[model samples]
Target: MARPRAPNRRATSCRCSWTICIEPDQGTRVKQRPGGMPPHPSQVLARRGLVTSLTWLALVAAPTVAQAQFGDPGGEGTAATDTGQIGAAALSTPRYMGADHNRLRALPYLSYRWANGWFVDGINGVGYGGSPTPGLQMGVHVGVSPDREESDDPALRGMGNVNRGAELGGFAHQRLGSWLGGKLSLRSHLRYGSGEDRQGGQAELGLGWGTRLGERSLMNLGLAANWANQGYMQTYFGVTRAQSTSSGYTEHKTDGGLRDLRLSLVVIQLFSPTTVGLLMVSQTYWQGDAADSPLVQEKRNTMAVAALMYRF
Candidate 1:
């Protein structure tokens, strides 16, 4: 009985405490919608101003991108330089570049010579054998006479025909007193035809002559000057790879005339009766003809000739 009575009281109390959860703050009065869109002018104007400012910023930035990507290299405002020479100090005359004032020279020379060619008088085989020879001729040195005969050297020497091609180099005749002398020559020749691309060799020989130039002796050496008169001059001295091509051909060529410049030494072994000896040297050609046909140019040239002359 006592337990039933307490239970009944607690049950009634629990039942009464079970109330509805009415959230008072959550059920606040709702603000009614403005009837037919009433205007807020200041807020609208502020929103409109922000949109306008944003549009202006976008428009200005669009052109700036292209200007940076497409404008000239030296920024937007500089000029180029490759306009010849510049600066006040640089605009000088052509003569200012090198030694233009000093001129070279063509010195004077004197010598007596006797050069004989049976061919000169149409006497074939008259020379070098017991054959009927052409009459020889005597003349003053028939070459560009120079001031120093003992030391002067000249005209380029080629060894073979142009069809064969040849080498180029310097040749010198050193006078070693009366009656004795020697010559120095360096040259090369090339071979024709296909397959074997061979270049030739050079020979430096010594020959002697006894002339009457008193103490100034003279000598005639072996193999003076040789030439090939083909009209074309190749850029190379040999049949180098550059010189040889499938199209590069070698042909028999001629200079029209006998292209021989005999370089010999002669003397008049006595002076009381006006003894005289002659040294006839060929020209040391520069590169080629300059003012004439098939003209060539030269680099530098040095030539000289000395003779002993005795006059009665």
Candidate 2:
């Protein structure tokens, strides 16, 4: 599976409950509340704020920790003190990008950055990351893309399984000046390794904004888009003639283009100078050729996560 990006320094967290719903024009009917009354206006705002907070938390915190240990942000090649973080995280996400169901996963949250720029973590995999110039950070790493099983969803009965494989990728993030009293940044990632053949490739680009909510809290808001090659899209979204014969879905072929768009929110709370808690929520909308695929049971996907970490 693709790993979520960690948060940066300019972000913070908030308190609220979030609800995900498709827009009226999306052709998906909204489920009414038990009383059939729409949510109050304040409730809607709160939910929106919650979403933004979670996305911001995930996007801002991680990079700041990594950069602090790798080197100073000014790219002066200064030798910084060694730092590391260890903890655990739980993630709730869709069984697959377009699956209507969800799954809960436990992940080891660990990262250590040496003064020389090399690092290992459950998030960014193993890589060397540092600011090559002021306001810019880049790195390369190797990670695993988890496999998909037909049993994951009954809808995939005869679609077969995809084996996990090694993926090679690199990432770049740049700080874009402040916006509305918050710091803004742009990030991009590209990798190869997704199908049974491990020949698929994917790319992501996003914008993140964050700010402090208080002495011990922060929040972040982000928007991102994903793209894939023909091999990757076909593997995940396409239904072959044989698959149609068995799965009872029409054969569908997918071509590469814009895949989906995502909006995320994150919130972070500090219990001590070295101990922190993070919560994040995100919504994704499938689009282009991927959306047209028969395997896509839901066009919108929601994901949530919570984690705790200690720095030493």
Best by lDDT: 2
Note the clash tally of each candidate: 26, 26
Candidate 1 residue-wise lDDT at 216 = 25
Considering summed lDDT, which 10 consecutive residues are worst modelled in model 1?
A: 64-73
List CA RMSD, all candidates.
48.8, 13.8
Question: Model 2: how far is 245 from its true place, Å?
Answer: 2.1
lDDT tens digits, residues 223-277, model 2? 8888889888888888889889988999999888888888877776756545667
Q: For model 1, how does the per-residue alpha-carbon lDDT over 1-312 read when each residue is reduced to its tens digit?
A: 522321111222221211111011111011222334312111111110111111111111121110001100111011011111000101111110011121222222121111121110110101111102111111111111001111111211221223222222222222232322322222212112211122222222222333222322233232322232332112122223322332243321222111222223322121221233332222222222211222112322222223332221
- Stretches of candidate 1 off by over 4 Å are 1-208, 219-233, 236-260, 264-293, 296-302, 305-312
Residue-level lDDT for 120 in candidate 1: 9
For model 1, what is the C-alpha lDDT against the true structure?
0.19
Clashes of 2: 26
Task: Estimate the TM-score of every prediction.
Answer: 0.19, 0.74
Tell me how far the alpha carbon of residue 136 in candidate 1 is from the true structure, in angstroms, after superposition.
30
